[model samples]
Target chain A: MISSSRFLPRVSGLALFLFLVVPAPSLVPARAADPAEIRIGYLHLAESKQQPISLLDEPTDDDGIAGARMAVEDNNGTGRFTNQHFSIEDMRLKPSDDAAAAAKSLIDKGILLIVVDLPPGMVLTAADAGRASGATLFDAGSSDDSLREEDCRANVIHTAPTRSMLADALAQYLAWKRWQRWLLVTGSHPQDALYADALKRAAKRFGSTIVEERIFKDTGGARRTDTGIVQTQRQMPVFTQNAPAYDVLVAADESNVFAGYLPYRTWDARPVAGSAGLVPTSWDPAHDSWGAVQMQNRFIKLAHRRMKAIDMQAWTAVRMIGEGATRTQSADPAKIVAYIKSPSFEIAAFKGQKLTLRDWNLQLRQPILLSDGRTVVSVSPQEGYLHQTSELDTLGYDRPETKCKLN
Target chain B: MQAQLIRRGRIRRWPPLWLSLALTVGATSSAFAYTAYVTNERDNTVSVVDLDKMQTVKTIQVGQRPRGIVISPDGKFLYICAGDDDIVQIVDTKSQQVVGDLPSGPDPELLALNKTGDLLYLSNENDALVTIIDVKERKALAQIPVGVEPEGMGVSPDGKIVVNTSETTNMAHFIDTDKRDVVANVLVDARPRYAEWKSDGSEVWVSAEVGGTVSVIDPVKHVVTKKITFSVPGLRSEAIQPVGIRFTKDGKLAFVALGPANRVAVVNAQTHEVEKYLLVGQRVWQLAFTPDQKYLISTNGVSNDISVIDVADLKVIKSIQVGSFPWGVAISPE
Candidate 1:
């Protein structure tokens, strides 16, 4: 209790230690600031907004989400040098949700790259919002060419195959199969009219003639019920009873309101093609040749689901980002954008040629595959329709016909 | 009597235990001694082989689409190119674990390590560029533009020359390692894939997958010097497409894996003559040789078995079952 000398020394030592430990924070030079992270946004249509068609299943979240995830993973996987990492923030819009507001929220989150799946109007609105945010938009849903034509935006890139490209692919195959005369059935919608326009253009390019044109109204009714098939059977045959004497019935039913019933029971007993019977797509699960099996396996393992054309498009878009990052060794958006637009660059998506983006419209030039519901029937560019630049340009808008000006 | 009995029992037990210990040590040292790493494409696993016993002892899971594998020159690490994952996975040879991943180009299919083990040349097939990676830093230093679908790659004997073969373009691009740029694009036959430089570095041999022949190109002149074609009775010319080509240590004998022909053609390098055709399993894709050059292993992709050929006799020795669709093969230098 009376160890005063020892207690005094201990107190003196504690004071010395405190004096040494305090202050001098300036010597450390605040830990170097972390690198800026790159964020990408994804927008898709909610399940309720998709037309209630029963011929095929509606696209799930995995279709768009998995692709964006793959793109991010691939980008970061190869973006190590540039210290760039891609993050996806997805916003799914319901039937009544404001698409522009949803896009604005994504932009607020520092997401400057967007992959969108929406209808034409919603896509245009999102693009307008994206432009204000200085974000780059990749449209993976809409096939309307007007988005790339009259309404073309400098900030947007169209990843979805155009309606004209799909129609041309189908028309080329039909022409090859000697189904020269087409009974064109147009639906009562703007989207259907666009598809019909593409079909007519393809028919002219491939030496096929439209024998007659008919209109199918969007008569609203219960699409899904236990008795839907019986009702469709009773209504279809009578509706198409007086069709023109054509080789095939090319139905322009993008909304799938009535074309699914046109096959096998057509008025002329001819085959049905387009939107319902034989459609053109970028990818199909049944395709197993040309190293597709490997890609399919990788997709299944990564996403835990089967791949669709939309997923493939997303994957390609993401892969393109990775390619740019890896090649430039820089994550600066300007550098990456430059590398992507460079003519020397090409990316292999397991298709025959390395794909490159068009300078004017930013659309990827690719060979389209014509598929029946079950399997791939043929691939287009059809041997003879040659282009001075690339054969793939023959399917879509060529250089001479382009209305896109980047400025 | 008690002392003698105790001494004898101790003596009897001592020798036996010592003998058992010695035998155990000997067998253990011989069994799991050398590590042989195999890249599995679909399973995403690298199977380690026990060289002494000649069997796969352990399987280690790795990144997606691990295709090319090469043990470091110092034999301390294994660099595996995971194509789908788009990185070169570095595995520590000592601990048999993935230590780090090196940044390569997008979709690296094949890789060739420099002699000093400091630089790695990776073939990024998707982007059509050869990404030069600094192995120690695990960073891509430069990307040299090449032809389309650049898959097969190899380094010259002196390590001064790098050759990349593009399948679709049918051209073998010769690159100067010092400059890190393409020096020449020698026109080859259709589907020029898989190139192998001679030990002396005088010429480079490339396999033409669709041409069914191997073009011997003079690297100095940058032209094809001669073409070697294979013909067999009852076999279509298209089926005899050549893929992997390798030469013996002395450079006197060359073996080419003729895909779909189910055979490996042994050629006299000097004479440019086919010595013999060793029958193998179906769809032979690649080959590897034991260190002593006494045994040759050919991977039959479709059959999923490795055909073992006795080098001396140039005949099929045995076939060992492996994983489904075994592609590339390499032997442990140790």
Candidate 2:
């Protein structure tokens, strides 16, 4: 009897050990620390010799550097687990500084992700430099579609909404509003020709006819004199007189020298759009609905200023990384990249729909909010332009037509 | 002499019996009669604390972003609103697994279960609608339109009245549950958030986010009774904006979580007076109380910690680190 009792106690102890030692089915595997740290570098471009008429002359925080900083802050806040740290080594390229050398410097700093705010030629050089370093470049400022088209590199993600997308958004809205006849005003610069080309394509797609086309030359003049407004008031009307009998004035001034004066005192009391009035932007501060207020408030508190569209895009990119890291519980770059590309993954950017990246051009597909400097007029793909897959694909270049072939 | 002898005999026999009975009753009463279940939002779990033991006995995982938890009237289930999931997850009190989900509106932030346990009012912020769901049927019955960015919903003591606050619009819409219509819209202040009705349904207090004041509104009159403001040293007025407010069961004392001030303000309900500010974790958003009212748990969103306040002393006893961005707290009745 004593032997039997001792045996029974030993059997119970074995059972208890089994119960304690065996892992529960609900217990998750412990996450391993990631070895690599993903770093992103940023570059900014501002015009040399502060020309008052140039858009780049404004010493504003509304640029790629500010956007990169916001992205870095957000990434570090929630992206620490993923071992992804964004560092901005901003080199403002002068007319003299070698853009390629700057790109090489950023690459040498171990920054695999590069966001550049530069013109098309400089962007191409930087892209080539980035290719040499095996770094992925994201154009946050430039609207030139050619960079993503003819000069597309294997390691470039175009975060900047293309000129085609902007034109299409505007065209659809104008077509819907029954503004079929457009008076296209092209600027003198080559940049203006590119925008004009996009505008012409937009007109073709939306079945709108360009009634008249005029070239607005950059007349050499002082911008901010005490008597400049009065002089401009007199000069602009003559410059804009007897142009066309169209419904709207579509200005393509990439350099905002002349278009800033074409809004109210247009030739035929027509509404101005395309680069000035009723502009299509990725994000606007007036956008407070759909939980955007919280994001806006947080941004303002963190940055001590208003957030621009570029800043919002950068913020979204970093937020996407953070979301992926948190959800996957691993910061492995490959895993994070895979998660971001998955169709099931959708991120809430305080925008109405969950934003997803287009696999074709590597551009973020987002609804373009049309603003007139004050209020949001409308959001586009104007009603009936349906896509075979996602509605957002209609905003940018579709998959079948994309020239971006990632090597 | 005969009477005295009889009394002494009776006393000797009764003393032992009465003493034994008294000891039995005392021991039973001293045992824990209640337990507090605290829903930790970040942990995505619930902590069950035995009041007598003063320690957590069990922790059970629930759904994502679980907030606004309440025990069923029958005490058979615990209903938790998983905000991100957009459903009211029902947990069986015995098994503790999320057994089912109720058809709540999209992005349901706050919830209030009616006294009968038949209805649940959910503030669907995204849709700007208050969804009424039949608890037993687990289906949404009606979606009533409210003001912009509706959040922080509560049912009045009578259960007939429901109050929902629109954060951006700075107004509280009082809805008659039976009629399923808005009875009154009372304008409070800038970004009026988190409404709590008085126990008697005589008053409804709403926290103003940007205005840094709590507006006390008379429910019957649907007018502002008074506004209680807070001014603390070295703190900006805008930073002292109130977010969460809770009153004692007797409605004597109230606790208001001041955002960015890193403190909870204790106020005398009757006097509408700010008594003292108990320092807590940063950016305190919501709070819950133990059933015995011995402890108050406040969720500090930015700090990612739950500050436990000792009720008697009105001081922070402990700051327990939890999950990331802890937004809500619900302590089960002790």
Candidate 3:
């Protein structure tokens, strides 16, 4: 079956043109038609030049796109039985490149499914550019809550978890552990402030009390100095002294300023939680239960690195597209998108449960893993917190709390 | 065994399980003892539990990551799918030692045996192929490609058809035993883990762990006839993931293992309705029934124990602690 399709490309120009222009569907049997080709576009912005705290924390060059590539292989494995084929066209945009123009070019090539790894602004730009073409966008990068709340788009589905979801997951675990009092530390960056805002909201929702709040200003200095921990060892304890008594120290450090240096440097001897210690994330390398070992092994063989959160989000987005195609059994994007948004649509991504899309805001519902860098400490939406619809709904903005009115 | 009794004109054919139970009561002065072999996926060991003793008798070291297990027809040997080793290990029941190995394909997560126990079907999860092996010869007959991530295998009652459920493809492929090709494909819900056929061969029930439902498929028409859904109060629907399924020999009752919900659903096989939910250990994976139909046992993955249920009363009678991450179970015939 594959040889016949491969043989068609080797024909002469006139023979191929005639084969293409002959309108052969009427003459040939339905089963003998070529496999339906489903092309997916992966649009990602170039990585920023910020250095990770540890040298071991550096990312691979194909961080998110490698996962999408592996999913394409998995899709083709399943597509053999369904008579369909899948391919991905990846586009990496530079700092000055227009994301909208990049998205339009993908749409011009007849790609209907686009997975975007971009910031919140660039995601919105690409989503708007594809809206008129009836192209669906999957947000695999941005975690800003506004993308799923006030700025939600009908054509864009978010596979990434929002900051509020991560914050709530951590707060729920803390509440379950009876650590009700938190000393919140905020970095001076804007993203850190937004994370701090989310943590405050979570603390209120989960009945935890923030005893005190402090700000750690980012001074103008190189992040990686020659005398790194020797200086940090003395500076951190003095900066954290004289805080109110708290069960835990929650650090909202999205800017990579100081969270990693706070675990053993706190003055009050409290465990750190938000960005460094016991961090909440969608996926982690230490997660091996619930058939995840198969996925981890396959990914390691593909990428030659441990799978990260972004890799998992990208993998899930592409797998969702593959699942939509298999269920509809057609290459039609309209049917596939409609099926994905329906009540019955669910995809299993080795998360020990099925992940479904929220009908109101187009966010994927999933469990958040709390990791301490070595192993998964726990998964959140902790024991007693319940929701009428799904236990996962308890971790993020519920239906009643969502401000999204999709267009 | 029951077929021999009916052939001797000792009992009626219908409701054979109950008649066999009654005969066991009249024939034995004490309760009949049956042995259960459970595969612990994490610890890579098999815990042997004596049903009458209601405790683990012995723990035997096996190959890496043992998950699926089955017993021979004459109750002489046990076949275990050592997934990481990628071979099916054969152990003698009486001697409790590894006797031999079958050439299963890569990553055999589940297996099924024909009534005569000569042919073995393995779902090689990583390879996406169903490998059929001749047990006595210990050679692979054929490796037939099915779907991606095949995890469940069920052979039809008459041994004419084999059903394999692929998790990622979310479909059940029915393969003809003689031709060894997929004759029909029936789409079901997501992440189907296990398949069970009715003794009368009227319907096949497939449990989808992620979709949280059991789709009842008609083997003849190759279509879903009905779906069984489970609900426990105060628990989310996603938490009620159905993995392993088993039905009574009389086909009146069905036991579905609900993973992470920490409960086992008792469903009416005839009506396809969930009758009751019995609370068990955390993350229940697979189930089995003793040969006499006296007890039902479940392997709880997270809690690392087995919950024993009285079949007649539908109550959890005993909880036996086993090795870590106990996943699959098989009981020996007395």
TM-score of every prediction relative to native: 0.57, 0.52, 0.89
Model 2 segments more than 4 A misplaced: A1-37, A46-57, A80-87, A320-345, B1-334
lDDT of 3 by residue, B1-334 (tens): 3342231233222225675466457445444668889999989999999766668999988899999999999999999999888778999988999988887767789999999999999997766778788888776665667777888999999999999999877889888888777877888898899999999999999999999999999999999999888889878787889999999999999999999998999999998888999878889989999887888999999889998887887877567889999999999887
Worst 10 residues of 2 chain B by lDDT: B1-10
Ten-residue segment with the worst summed lDDT in candidate 2 chain A?
A1-10
> Per-residue lDDT tens digits of candidate 1, residues A188-306?
98888989999999999889999988889997766778877786777777777776668988999887788878887665688888887787888777666545655676568678878
Indicate the residue-level lDDT of A317 in model 3. Answer: 92
Ranking by DockQ: 3, 1, 2
By descending TM-score, how would the candidates be arranged?
3, 1, 2
Whole-model alpha-carbon lDDT for candidate 2:
0.70
Best by TM-score: 3
> Each candidate's interface RMSD, rounded to one decimal?
23.2, 23.3, 11.4
CAPRI-style quality class for the chain A–B interface of candidate 3? acceptable
1 against 3, candidate with superior lDDT: 3
Instruction: Provide the lDDT at A311 for model 3.
Output: 93
Residue B190 local lDDT, model 3: 88
DockQ per candidate, 2 decimals: 0.03, 0.01, 0.26
Clashes of each: 0, 2, 0
lDDT tens readout by residue for model 2, A177-201: 9898998888998888898899899
User: How high is the lDDT of residue A14 in model 2?
Assistant: 47
